[model samples]
Target: MTSEKGIAAVEFALALMGLLLFFAIFIQFFIFFAANERATFAGFAASRVFSVQGIGPAVETSEKIDSDSIMTFETNRVAVARQIPMPSGINNFLTQGRGFSIEIEIPTFNELDYKNRLEQDDNDF
Candidate 1:
């Protein structure tokens, strides 16, 4: 009877540990999804800004880097919050202030034969 009680306690302890681990992973993935969506928005915003106004002709060299700090639209704090909590005691101790960035060679002016197909589609209608 005593052995049964000990085994039950052990099983419950193991189950609790596993449950906690699963919950922690679930929470991390949830936050990852949130960050991904936010990043998509930020990328679209940056692209829109450059596609219309362009990436040059107004650069003070410090104004357009597309990072979280450079682009205010990228306000997702996941990169800041999702730090690996180890290897502490250094200059970057608690946080690295890491963030996402968007850097791409934005082709323009009929590049890739990508004409305004919408105008042609409108004629069909």
Candidate 2:
């Protein structure tokens, strides 16, 4: 009876360890996914601002997203980047940082040129 109880306890401990490991991995994956989503949202928001308000304000808004994230603007495009924070225990082997970068292009429009083109099209018709 005593030996059987010890064996059961050992089995339970092993199962518990496996469960803990799975939980840790789940948490890490959740963090990576959430961070990527946030980075993508920030990129789109910045791109929207760039399309409407111009580059300066858009860059400023993106820079304010988060300290761990980076935002860059090039011509009519904006990109937001971020790194996911992993749990300390898994840092040695899985310490590989997960991150996401979202890039968006905003089209520029010339109102005068567009109007002229429209008029020429109407004349041709």
Candidate 3:
């Protein structure tokens, strides 16, 4: 029979490489999801802060967010995103950053009240 020495070893090595590649992909997805979850939480937290802090007289009180803190409140939530475990070229195909940024929109009570008043006036007519 022909020499088949180290054939099984080569096959095993190839299989192991495939498994490692799959595992790397799986881990990257996990990281992406985890970071997304964290970003979501931060969004909610930022909204809460905006709502709670941008209350009555806050606009008058603070120089920033003045004239209507509720309306003028602007901030950004930064989320650290992870690149898929791959070569630079492949990773670039996936994404090109160590993180991502999210902009949170907080409802302005003044605008809501103004709209509500307009609606009520229209209803009265």
TM-score for each predicted model, relative to the true structure: 0.50, 0.69, 0.50
* Alpha-carbon lDDT of model 3: 0.48
What is the per-residue lDDT of model 3 for residues 12-115, given as tens digits with 9 covering 90 to 100?
Answer: 89999999989987886776566555444444444445445753343333323221112234433222222223456646666563333333343433456668
Per-residue lDDT of 1-125 in model 2, one digit per residue for the tens? 99999999999999999999899779877877777766777777777787678888876776677455677766556666565665555665554443333333433344566699999999998
In model 3, the clashing pairs are 81-99
State which candidate, 2 or 3, has the greater TM-score: 2
What is the TM-score (0 to 1) of candidate 2?
Answer: 0.69
Error of 3 at 28 (Å): 0.7
Top candidate by lDDT: 2
Question: Can you list the residue pairs that collide in candidate 2?
Answer: none
Model 1 C-alpha lDDT versus the unseen true structure: 0.44
List where candidate 2 sits over 4 angstroms from the true fold.
63-67, 95-125
Residues 39-118 of candidate 1: C-alpha lDDT, one tens digit per residue: 44544445455444554521222233323323322222111112222222321442454332233222233322345576
Off by over 4 Å in 3: 1-5, 55-90, 96-125
Candidate 3, run of 10 with poorest lDDT: 62-71
